[model samples]
Target: MGTISPIKESTCCDPASAGTVYLPSGTSLILLMPRLLATTIHGAVDVLKKTFDGTYDDNCPACGETHAHGGICCGIPEIHCPSPCVCSIHWVGCPGDSFKHAIQVTNTSKTEREFTLTSVPFPHTQEAVAVTPGKQTLGTEESLQAEASFTIPETFAGSKYRTVIKVKGAYEQIIQVCLTVRPRQACGCHVEQGDIPKRVKAHHWYHHFQCVEDCFEPAKKVG
Candidate 1:
């Protein structure tokens, strides 16, 4: 038979401590050591706060506001600066006249934003293109319309040309504008000019070097 050992009083399970104590009558006993723990309401709250960051109803980290024009993502507010408010013009012409269009820019941010507009002219171009109010500042949720003009030179005779309009600053956008030159029909006549009386011929369905008396009219009148 095995002999049983008695438990020491000093080593007994204490009610103040967190542990389990068991006695096997006059046989054996088992004991489990207690584990210490320290926690407070403030500590628990901090843990919860870290777990649910940027949840709904929380302030935005980017703009430091509860709401923004664009929704929040990853605790950051969406910035909508220099967003284009205008649509691109595919083709513009007025038959020996100038073309003009309106371009709108919007600043959806909560603060002011700077903007600049410039044009990229193509090679072998004779017309002059420009933008009005090219550079300016915009306020929150504010918008501005810039006028774009393209003057067709009398010497312009190309079928079409493309110009790239660029807006730079807080935001950026590239708008492509295509301009077409009106075609001039053949007048089926000849013109004499210059010191030597240069003569110009009219090709089939094409304009002559010089304008004729009845170049573009209902009835043909040679002069």
Candidate 2:
């Protein structure tokens, strides 16, 4: 025998608002609050996961795809100088021998530039290394063919020598040189002709001789 009150309108259902929920009188607000908070937290985590997992392209800001050179961005070091800004050269020889290699350098820039070439020896005497055309001027796209040599002294005991040739111009280029000097006697093994087995297969005989040769090989230095 009591009259029911009219249901008042609730403003919490607006889309512009946050995790606000309207509850009727006598409803369990405590139970609904956790569910609302959980939903809001789950939605926020999903958004964050998607943002972090988004795929992106490797588009360089300095030089775009149009200016890429040799599969590298033009603004980087690999193609900045003359196709390759850094390189390595290796040579194997005997002691008291001189080894020479030709190095081709080009000016890839748009203007004339002068390059000064210098060598920095590593664990070796400075007199052992030499580079020709120490200084040269090149027009745009012009190339220079230079020579680098390493002379192993007769009394040198080490089997390895290294040097770095630095070319300085608008951009610096690094050339790493490694020289391996071995004794003449270390080149081959001295297996007697009578040591071969007459009944062995050709491949097996070859393998056996290779292993024997390796056993007599001298220790080589790694650069």
TM-score of each predicted structure versus truth: 0.42, 0.46
Q: What overall lDDT, based on C-alpha atoms, would model 1 receive against the true structure? A: 0.66
Candidate 2 off by > 4 Å: 1-85, 183-223
Q: Choose the strongest candidate by TM-score.
A: 2
The CA lDDT at 80 in model 1 is 71
lDDT for each residue of candidate 2 in 1-223, tens digit (9 for 90 to 100): 9999999987675577667775666567667888899999999998777555542234546566443223456454345535543888898876667888888889999989998888886674645468898889999999888998876776654467777789888877788888777876775579664333334234565465522233233355556
Clashing pairs in 1: none
Off by over 4 Å in 1: 1-86, 186-223
| Deviation from native of the Cα of residue 52 in model 2, angstroms | 19
Evaluated at residue 176, the lDDT of candidate 2 is: 84
Let me know the TM-score candidate 1 reaches against the reference structure.
0.42
Question: Weakest 10 consecutive residues, lDDT, candidate 2?
Answer: 210-219
Write down the lDDT of every candidate, Cα atoms only. 0.66, 0.71
Residue range 1-223, candidate 1, lDDT tens digits:
9999998667675677667665555432222211112245566777777556633455566667775335655454467766463446665454567678888888888889898888877557544468998988999878878998876666655478776788886666787887776655431247774333334556666644554353244454557
lDDT of candidate 2 at residue 89, scale 0 to 100: 83
